[model samples]
Target: MEAVYIDKHYGLVAECKQGSKKACYELYRLYSKAMLNVAYRIVGNIEEAEDVLQESFVDAFAKLKDFRQETTFGLWLKQIVVNRAINLLRKRRLDLTELEDGHLENIVDKEEDDQEEIQYQVAQVKQAIQLLPEGYRIVLSLYLLEGYDHEEIGQILKINENTSRTQFLRAKRKLMEILRQKGNVA
Candidate 1:
């Protein structure tokens, strides 16, 4: 049974690498829901998330040769979806920075015990993020939700690392304020 599972997994990957459109469709069917979740988290709109998913998959297939199998195929696809979503946010011109220093030394640590609370907090944060200017929203989504560090964010956004860090701080502060206003936080 396990062997059959493994064969289907590896076979799909190999066929995908071989540029089979059928394999691509199979891959999409397997991962599209998860990818859409990630896209919705970042893009904050169902329609936009769908667009990002479509565009990311197209790019992923075109650049499939560059995909090394080191990471699971899902993770690789996630990176592409996140990058495309960020680009879409940027094109909309959202100004994402709400803090000056880009330092969040005092933000509460996220522990396992905080998981439920954090999820609730994230809902509020997402609402706040949607309210941000386009640039700030993009920076915040890439840095916070997508888990790209400052250097990588800078590269993706064509800005310097310091700018990414600053934008992150601003985004955090704005999110906090929004949550507080919504009575989700103190």
Candidate 2:
């Protein structure tokens, strides 16, 4: 058996490739809000997220000819947005390679214990995520929200795969702590 895929935006992308300004605008309108949210989740700043969104769109359109349509346009654009957001973080000296010693096992133990009964509202979780440290927030957002695996995140952030795993673990532990402190966990 063979697998087939379809993209609803195929016609729009084809028109974009043909330099139809209207198609380009329509594509942008279709994708911008969701892409902006993806960026904001990684960058954790609305303004920077907007900048990443715009840059990703500009880059995507400029390189549209290179896109082979093996995947949906949204997925391709998301890769670009993720890359640009990571680059922006790097410019601000983001480092995911730094190792914190001696406390990870303890965090894991406590996290497991505390997480078993925790319940949180959507808004609370979102607020708590915004309060996380940059490294943790990025790792958590990429892993949990954006559905990137630790190996993929390691490649994206230029860190070891184990490092990405550690970051994710720590991020989860810290997020739980924040939720507890804020009394958002039930």
Candidate 3:
């Protein structure tokens, strides 16, 4: 199944490299919605996400000739999208700080029983994530929603790997607190 997907995009990408508009549109049709969702998750706004989606595709298409399938086309495209989303945030004066070994862990409970929790609706979970401070929200979105490991997230966000881990743990606990406030904790 993975091979089939790779094969399909490979052909479209080849055509796109050769300046095929139809092929580019076909590729965009296949991935645009997912791209929009990724952008929205990062930016947390509809208009900015859509703008990022357009810019990402434009940039990706321009650089199509350099794409060697070391990774899947989708993964390559997602990297571009994520970088662009971060850039957009930067344009809005989002300042990413390095934790000075701030001992954030002291506030995070480690007890096993504290992990027990009730199920949250998808909307509620999303709402809670949106309510997070930008740093925590972006780290959580990249690590959990986008499946980036701490090292990868650190590279992407230009922070220490340990900082990414700390941010993720803090985001998890903060999310739980939000859910608890909403009476969703068991």
| Model 2 per-residue lDDT tens digits across residues 1-186 | 433347899999999999999999999999998898899778766767789999999999999998887789999899999999989998985533322232111212325655543322554577677777888889999999899999999998989999999999999999999889988765
Report the alpha-carbon TM-score of model 2 versus the true structure: 0.79
Instruction: Give lDDT tens digits, candidate 1, residues 29-52.
Output: 998987887786666677777899
Local distance difference test, candidate 2? 0.82
Candidate 3 global TM-score: 0.81
Once all C-alphas are superposed, what RMSD does model 1 give against the true structure? 8.9
TM-score of each: 0.69, 0.79, 0.81
Candidate 1 Cα errors over 4 Å, as ranges: 1-10, 19-22, 66-72, 92-122
lDDT of 3 by residue, 16-125 (tens): 99989999999999999889888888888767878999999999998998888878899999999999999899889543232222211132234655433312255567
Off by over 4 Å in 3: 1-7, 94-120
lDDT of 1: 0.74
For all candidates in order, the CA lDDT equals: 0.74, 0.82, 0.82
Instruction: List candidate 2 segments past 4 Å from native.
Output: 1-5, 93-120
